[model samples]
Target: MHDKTAAPENQHLSHRTAWLRAAVLGANDGLISTASLVVGVISAGGDAVLAGIAGVVGGAMSMAAGEYVSVSSQADTEKADIELERQHLANNPEYEVEELAQIYRERGLTQELSHQVAEQLMAHDALAAHTRDELGITDQLQARPTLAALSSFFAFLFGAVWPLLAAWLNVTFLFPHPLITIAVGTAIMLILLGGLAAKMGGASVTHGAIRVCLWGLLAMLATALTGRLFALVVG
Candidate 1:
């Protein structure tokens, strides 16, 4: 007999995993992409304010749309799986029970114990039991499309603001060399963002920082090249 008191603890862990994954992914993408965009535009001699605003707005919309589509698909798949499980339970419950029993048996339970466990579980909540134990579906990991979209959009907006601030301050004539100031500020911010993401994800901070910085550099280089080409063509 499982201790009912332990359910909350398990649920909390699952929830943490889901939210943490989404938050980290959102922040990381926001930092990397927004920084890259601003850096690229600045390298091309674009107005800092315009570059920053464009980066923030574009990144937010992209993140929201991408997250919505991805999470919606995930939710759809989960729904389909649950529906299939429901059908199987309705059409061939005996077989489903046997399947559940076999799963328990594989986990070291004796055949008799497995059968009893499956029976008790099915009696209490058949769908929940099969969805969890058999299908490995949990309420915590269930994707909420709307929540995912909102979270991603907001998180990206927040992360993108730092770069925008750098650009805005550059435009205010506060910095001696606005471009250099923006570049340096963006580089430091990217390093910080990467380190934060790595710490959260239990990854190497150095590697993450290097990866982000390299991408930003690449974006700047590409944009600068494009700008020079255009200037040449116009001249």
Candidate 2:
């Protein structure tokens, strides 16, 4: 039996804007930084597990704090803009209407029809219309500091845990070299994380995986080289 009243399956991905950026950035930073730190420590004959743990904790907290402050600043700007719009509407209602109508007219609507549509929309919800069409603020795209902070915090923890776990496994199993295990494991995880993020964002999986893994490997290599140089100098 065919169901004619079935809801539409198509959906836009823009709604993920609030948290997707924070999550992807935090996860990538955490994975690469923690892996690099651990590899460096291992190269320098230091404790890989300890360095991994410290890196994860410090990195996660820093990511959360940074995301919160940055997003909060954006939120403040949005609020100020919205408030300014409110003031303009209160002080000059007619001017605001014509302004909105002009925006519609620029969008291809006829002059008379634009004015009518603007008036009706303003009569219903002037602030919403102006905020969305004029100022480009919408509910889905609005800044939310708390959500961003939490997303980064958890995403960082998720990404950092892999390298830390690899380090621990190497120590526990007496692996020949912690560097090999940690670097390989971190690279694999970064590739997976990149592909997953890309899938969620409707991007190319192969491109994302290769891009993240390459950068992560480069970071770990550079850090490990610095550590080797430091070890040689100190010894």
Candidate 3:
């Protein structure tokens, strides 16, 4: 008697995991880069408001271009791979079936059952069966160029807004020396972003926060030194 109720547990879950990884990575990049940019600009003696606005605009455009190009390239490669797999399947169905059966056998299935499972899956949906079992490709996480680009761009811009707003508020009314205030605000914000990212990624929150703060400080220091050196030379 065939065990009709038995369903493969690992396959579908793996697809979800892949998509989560991509999304989390995208969001993390957005936060770190935007924060660093804003900090650098503020440290270079730019007015806090101007620095904030520039960071928002620059981060958004950079994210969009970067994400679009990267994900588009990945999507193209995936398309090519799929096309190749399709052609291979068409040209050599028997060999393809055997290959899938072999994969199942390698995964601890007996030869007879593996053959039966592969044949049954192929009969229902040859392309899907090959995509999953042979190519390890899943529909859920199939790269969408536009979606990835838009999400990255907007998330970066949104993430940048916090530090920008802190700078603006500090400069406008709260602080006599806006640079110091902005620096402090930005450091705190970086720590928060890092902690959030670490939590989501299942990492050490303190370590991530400290790492981000250190990088932001280094970038800001470099920019500040450059600005001072330029001023000295010009004067």
Candidate 4:
């Protein structure tokens, strides 16, 4: 028996897939980019405080703008596709129903049962049935430009805090050059962030943590080398 009901809120766990991807990518960008900026600027004998501030603020804004534009474009495309689907259903509904049933059949339903399910579901909500079965789209999968933008912006801001604060504290209070401590802090934070995100997404925690940390190490190394080149040039 079909449940004949929707949970309203948790109807689709697939909805979180895009959000998780965007957020994890955004926050990792924020943390790594800002941290790299901090390390580079300080290594080049510049003001760490000012550099950290610039990285956090500038990187956050950039993340927000990029996410908004990219996700908005995707949303626009999906909207257009949905509109086209709606037209097809209106103009050639019988064909659409067959298409829906065929989709179910391809998913392992018997031909007769597939038709019955399609017919029943179409009777309940024709457009929804076609969209879900034929087009593989749903309300849960619809993109939200505003939500993507905000999540990216805030996630980046949150991730940037680790390296920025570590470098600043070491410089002002503990050490003359904070590169070692900054590296240590950044490595730990990246591991934690990746592990937590992977855990939430039911992915391998070790793999995620190692991947992010390795990339982070590379980014920082490249930026630090750039700082060295700049310092030599200035000299």
- TM-scores for all candidates: the values are 0.84, 0.91, 0.81, 0.86
Q: How do the residues 54-123 of candidate 4 rate in per-residue lDDT, one tens digit apiece? A: 8899899888898789978988887787789889988998998798888889899999999999889989
lDDT (Cα, 0-100) at 167 in candidate 4: 79
lDDT by residue (117-206, candidate 3, tens digit) is 889998898888888777777887577889877877766766667667766677667767655655677677778767766665667889
Query: Relative to the true structure, how large is the alpha-carbon lDDT of every model?
Result: 0.77, 0.89, 0.71, 0.84
Please rank every candidate by lDDT, starting with the best. Answer: 2, 4, 1, 3
Best by lDDT: 2
Give the worst 10-residue stretch by lDDT in candidate 1: 9-18
Model 2 residue 198 distance off true place after TM-score fit, in angstroms:
2.3
Report model 3's TM-score to 2 decimal places. Answer: 0.81
> How much is the lDDT of residue 205 in candidate 1?
89
Off by more than 4 A, model 4: 1-21
Question: Candidate 2's C-alpha lDDT?
Answer: 0.89
> Residue-wise lDDT of candidate 1 within 77-187, one digit each (tens)?
999999999999999999999999999999999999999999999999999999999889898778899998899998888767876787777777577775566567767
Stretches > 4 Å off in candidate 3: 1-48
Arrange candidates by TM-score, highest first: which order?
Answer: 2, 4, 1, 3
